[model samples]
Target: MMTVVRLMALALLLACGLAQPASAQVQAQAPAQAQLRNPATLAVEGPVLPGETVEVAIAFAPREGWHGYWFNPGDAGKGMELRWDLPPGWRAGEPRYPVPETLFAFGFMNHVYKSPYAVLVPLTVPADAAEGPTLIGVRAEYLACSDSLCVRETAELIGNVVVGADGRRDPRFARWEAKIPPRIDATARVEREGETLRIAIPLPQTQALGRPHVFIAEDGLVQYGEQQAFYRGEDRLVAVLAAKGDANPSSLSGVLRFGNSGRGIAFTAERGPVGLGSTTPLEASNAPSIGWLFLAAFVGGIVLNILPCVFPILSLKALHLARAGESESAARRDALAYTGGVMIAVLGLGVLLLALRAGGEQVGWAFQLQQPGIVLALLVLVTAITANLAGVFELPTLAGRRQASGSFATGLLAAFIATPCTGPFMAAALGAALILPTQYALGLFAALGLGFALPFLLLGFVPALRSRLPRPGGWMAHFRRWMALPMGVTALAVLWLAVRIGGWPFAAIGLAIALVVIAMLMGAGRRQRGGRPVGGGMIAGGLAVVLALAVVAPRWIDEVEADAGVLDPADFSEATLAQAKATGRPVFLWFTADWCLTCKVNEKVAIEREATRDAFADAGVIAIRGDWTRSNPAITRYLESKGVAGIPLYVWIDRDGEEQVLPQVLGPDSLIDLAGASPKTPARGTPQ
Candidate 1:
């Protein structure tokens, strides 16, 4: 909510416009007795020449725990006002303020200078003015505020400047000028869309940015307290800001604060198209190189083989590995074929992801699982695999060539299912892929595929490892049948995911389609056993499945309620996050999806437990749950902001706004320990 003070300030600006000087506004609210809590003094820097401009500095030294405002006081507070009294034909320019720190108090944002600071105003002398000492003075009025209190202060400051005398320049003027932000050489462009303002500023790609912030000088142009999102392209920086009310202006002027370094660049933006360019986050300048990202992706892929989501697919691969022990050449061939399959699948998905994002889609890793159609397809495929494992059907083996094809198909399935479960190093690699260049990003994806296939590839090439495997025997059949159990479980999980993403009706139709496909497969198996042709049944079954999907696609709608757990967390949103942090309570924010097995595992082990719940209750923790079961732009943006591509992301923001990102794998005591940690005193305007 916009505060009344800010609203009134904006209304006054709209009514009076820029033509009405700040001094008049100050005089309207001036107190009879001046408050000098934050004392001000005036100084002239120079031996001013007749027609030249010399800077006049209004220096302020605020008392402890008190601060003065900038030219634009942000959401609330009064900007300093100056009523200049100079000789005829003399002129004064607008006051130039140094970059100010942000203060967040009671849901309002204030731009203030806490320590000693100066505002430089250029005073231009007339060409006809006498070359002699002249008196210059200003009645400065401003607001001084501590954390809980504010006072309107006024001061009458005077300075003398000798026009013709050779007076030495004040050394202090150099320091004051350094504090002021210099104007950028390139022009910036801004565009307004509804309540959002997007500004594109040209900057070198090599420029290092740390938590960049934009301070718009135009009153009512933007909601000062709203979170600003920054992104970087090849040679441009884009800033997204929320506009305040219905205010629309032809041009905008502001200062771009480069993190907390007290350095900024002043920019004026005119109405124009602002291209978002790449989805790269501004922090990517500090990100690791492509080689490191590739290595991380590879390692992450190896770890995925151990997660529960890949177990169903790994079962088939295990059998393939055992068969590889037969002959070295055969084993190598199978390995290469399987590796090719995995690479093709992983890279294909990566290409699709990149293309969709380029086409302006808000999506992330495991994005296919969000679609009901894709989920249904997966369910049907897993069901067929389960039936084959259970001996209800058998896929005909075509000697060496068939073996290779089977390995390749298995690789494709493994990569598709395994990608959803981000393990260890995979998150960072995948997150960087979203912002990296096309060629480099594709390399990372290829690295992930190669890594995933490395273990199997090794088995095919290394005879020593192959010899260690148990010899193919009569027990192999029994093992395959037992493997059906996990595959069956995988099918059930996919069905559940379908229900979670779509409604019960959609899930029911999908289940019927899967059953129809399974029945057709079983019929074909029976025919094969009876030594008859079975191709017609499979073709008919495929047609039936396609027809059913076509009929139900349009009617699909998401109606499933969010999963309930012991924690009883609130649904996450940007507004909710802000409100939670504003309360000065510890926040436990976790992102999950029905399709993510790791997310569920963490919930069962660490989150949805009586101990964790009690700890949170005792600590007064605010739990926020972000469900990514469907395509949510907000959740996607939040994940990108945290430098991750997918979730099972657990972020703990303490009362003081310090954030600690918990690991993907959570222990039973992880949340318990977090809740028990000592609280720190909340700091004003701390970044969350």
Candidate 2:
């Protein structure tokens, strides 16, 4: 009776199992949530040729509010894990992904794609395969998430590709391929600083990378989703990333993301010091070393002593040295003081320049002369000097005084005027100074001042040089008078510069101030000659009024129209140069300042001449001039790019868009010859 009952129970259980529907059982076995989301689809890009490789893409189109993870998913998601099913003699390469966007949800950061995207895998066919269709399949495991919910999904994707003699490309493949970050020929250095890693890469200093971010590919090296700090050092791009615990990878590999372009480059980290390689125009990889730069600065200063703008001043100083011949001890003392003054002046100017740069001011050589007020002040001083030289006043104390202060003042004046000329070798040294360490830059300036004062310093020590100078006599008076002519010319040049920089009205006011100051000086001379206190008081009051005017004039003067016929070349801008180069035409670019006499001479001789202009027009040359008359940061940066510290920077770009740096001092035929010569594409770094 028990055997019969047990058999009945087993038969009833079997009947109940048979009654259930097969589709319902299958649906119950697989989670209903997994079936709700669509699976990814796989497709071959095009026909695959035997022995040739073609792209096989696994594409996913997420539903609204859902997203897919990138190769290196951040914080809280899983990337696509592919299990490939391939034919016997076939291979599949690693997946290539497009740049990813950041997604934040529930206190977790994710690198994901919210829209449809494809991951590309290279599929290779067997060399001897027959012309037939082959099935490629992949089992993809990924995590898909919306803002509120997340799900782990599995998709079985398959595609068919035809093996043919020649392969055809798919349009979809091109789109995905374009999105993948390009591999860059770059090296990086990872510097571990406590809890942060400074990853430095060699990128162009000129690139405007706005708030750049880094996406590390290596696991556990960096804390993803943490804020990245970016900085630029010379030519290196650096990112400060929060480190994950004590994890330090032998090499860091990553992608650098700029904004909205969805463009980036993959870089493999090089194990070494975090070097901000050659961040300056002067410190370019191929530029001269520090020692050579110092030598260049010294040599440049020596050359400045002979430039036309400086020649007259040297003559006056030399004459002063001759007057000192009466007492060797006094001469030596004066020379020391003058050298001290020169060094002090140069270093002081250097300090000001560095300070301004630190404060983010766009300043360069002779920057002080850019201001109308300073120009007017210098004009007055020079005019007064000329009058004294011409015997309008007996201010022989300037050079003939036994006091060291007079020599000191002369040294300061020499340095002041010397700023307007960039001698041979100066452009490189000074440009380097701007980018070098602060101390190194100051050292260069000191060397330059030492060179400028060398001649006078030598005369004090070497009695033979001093003996060579003619003894002081009445003829010295006549020589001094003749020097007044050059001094007056210098004053007139300042006046002209005032007009160029501040316009005609400013120049007119400067002229009126000069006349008034000259009259006051004349009155003081008369007072001394006639022994009259009344004349002295008149002179004092006149000077006060002149000072007041000087302080007030620049603020009130109307900047009027500039004089024409001086070759008003188109103002040079980066855009202008780029546009000119894009036209496939040659370009002539020159940087000039109102105060740079060498620049003026070059313009009048080479650029402004009729022959040069005609040649430029005929050759379709774009003539562009950068006026450094004011504090133009753009021009300053451009000058630095060419390793130039001062003006008269002439750059010639041939039709091939190669830059040729022309000589600083150009002759009448220089531009004409340059323009007439047919453009030749230069090899890398051929001297301009």
Candidate 3:
């Protein structure tokens, strides 16, 4: 027992004190030898003959769980770079990289070599080179990364080659040479649209291609992260790639690979049309049926009534409905005229939009609002309405004696106001309509007009609804005065839009014109109240002058604003979105326009709030906003891709690349909750 106790005490002493030196020796010995061995090996693949070319390779066999990069590293990483030290009259060409496999890391896709790969470099031996052995040296720089960590590596390489000898090529080098892409004589055409480049390569019609991918050779010309879409044509293969960095390139050279075949053809691009005209060639199988499109258009028009832009006009019309106590036949006649007005306005605008699109102009819903003149015209019209509603002047009654003409004009105004506020259901139908056959497209627009007129049409035919309305009385006068408030607000909103579209000079001039028109309206109202005969003619002349001035003022102000050359901060684009996405974090996208009331309201109440900003910061969310105040093809194409008809588009892309689309009308809490940092209770941004 005493002997065992003495042994235990000796073991404890060794464990506590004497083990430190032994452990240190083991760790020190193990690290020195491992660190000295390089992970890569450099070799000369062929004997360097006098005045002959030879090949050299820098081969890497990575450690377990680590990998190196290809020529175009993709997303994030550094490709191998070599600085060659050659003798006099010796030259080194660009390195030839083997085809790399796709590896994903940290929410990014990387082109990497996971196991073993070799990069070959060509050397030119001068005619005057000596016959003895020559020393070739290189310094290589590269990056290696595992799933969790990344490390940069630098290697110094040296190799000896016998000059003036019969060169024997390495069989291993032959294997890598076979993997190099062969240059093809195929015709390549490239078309540029916004930041996207579309390349069309003429492939033999008889050949069948399965899942082809294009690997671009030039750096800073294409975004490596966005998916490249390939479309097979009868005799051509087309690829759509996102462009980055430089806009102008002499040629785009890339390798086109078929799935897993280790075979590809490389070609340089030339600028020309691919015979596609203006329409994008999408797969026909994914298109919705015509019936579904019509239904979507109808439903979208119905939803428009609830939009902020249209709802206020509806409120104004509701007050007018209370005074409809005329004979049933007369009331029905006025309703039909109003319905005709709304239908004509919608159909006419649709025709104009289609005409412009057919003429190769890129336009979409509420495209007229992009015109400063049209905005200013609408402002004048709305201002006149506000004055009339405020009892500045009584509009002359139509031949029917109940302002049937006024009802028709109101319908026209309502249709105009409703154009800017596109809802969810409208997006798909309208997007398809823009690209569908002409007759079918027109039919969709007509259906939308019918839907817009539905509510008023029902009131016209249904006598019961009219009977239920309150009788006209002294209360209407008070209501008309109150109604002017919203109308006045609408006028101010238009003036604000003018400022946004043009500048402060435009707004100041517009406000001055509005005040002048108001004075004329009051004068006419006084003259009519005094029983004067010529008051109506003066008011008519004044309205005409107001319209003329509003149209002409924009040209003058545009020159000045153009000279000032101010930049708007909110015009986020696809390139900006791409940059934000490259961060491997969440992104919040918002599309808005100067004329969209709901967009403005959402911007103020939800997007621009301090809480929302804080939530976004906490969640590492990047906020990007797109401005659609003008005709922007890039923005239009982006909207089409997402099936959005107009502004107030909210898109949330998470870290894992899943997308969530938020509602057009949003509250601060909706975005705040969505931007929360909890992964377990991740906020869903999809529209309800």
Best by lDDT: 1
Kindly list the per-residue Cα lDDT of model 3 for residues 371-439, writing each as its tens digit. 877877777777877887777777743111366776687677777788667775676677666656578
lDDT per model vs. reference: 0.78, 0.71, 0.68
Query: Candidate 3 at residue 409, lDDT?
Result: 71
lDDT of 1: 0.78
TM-score of each: 0.60, 0.59, 0.56
The model with the greatest TM-score is 1
Candidate 1 displacement at residue 493 in angstroms: 1.3
Model 1, position 540: C-alpha lDDT score? 81
Q: Which 10 consecutive positions of candidate 2 have the poorest summed lDDT?
A: 679-688
Q: What are the per-residue Cα lDDT tens digits for candidate 1 across 1-688?
A: 3357787644544464522345643653443333466888888998888999999999989988988998888887888878989999999998898888999876778899998999999999999889879998889878777665565677888889889768898877766765676564345789987789988876544333456899998887888889998888754678999987776667989988766656566778888887675647665643355666788999988888887667657567766766776678888888998899999999999999987765446678879888877887788888888888888777843111237887888888889988876888888888777766678779989999998999999998988998898876677778778778887888887887778888787888778877877787788779888998878757686767767675775497567779667888888887778777777878899999888888888999999999999998788788899999988877876675555678778888788655667889999999999899846444333223
> C-alpha displacement of 16 in model 1, angstroms?
36
Span of 10 residues, lowest total lDDT, candidate 3? 559-568
Q: Which digits, one per residue and each the tens of the lDDT, describe model 2 over residues 292-322?
A: 8889889888888776557536545765666
* Deviation (Å) of 660 in candidate 3: 3.3
Candidate 3 global TM-score: 0.56
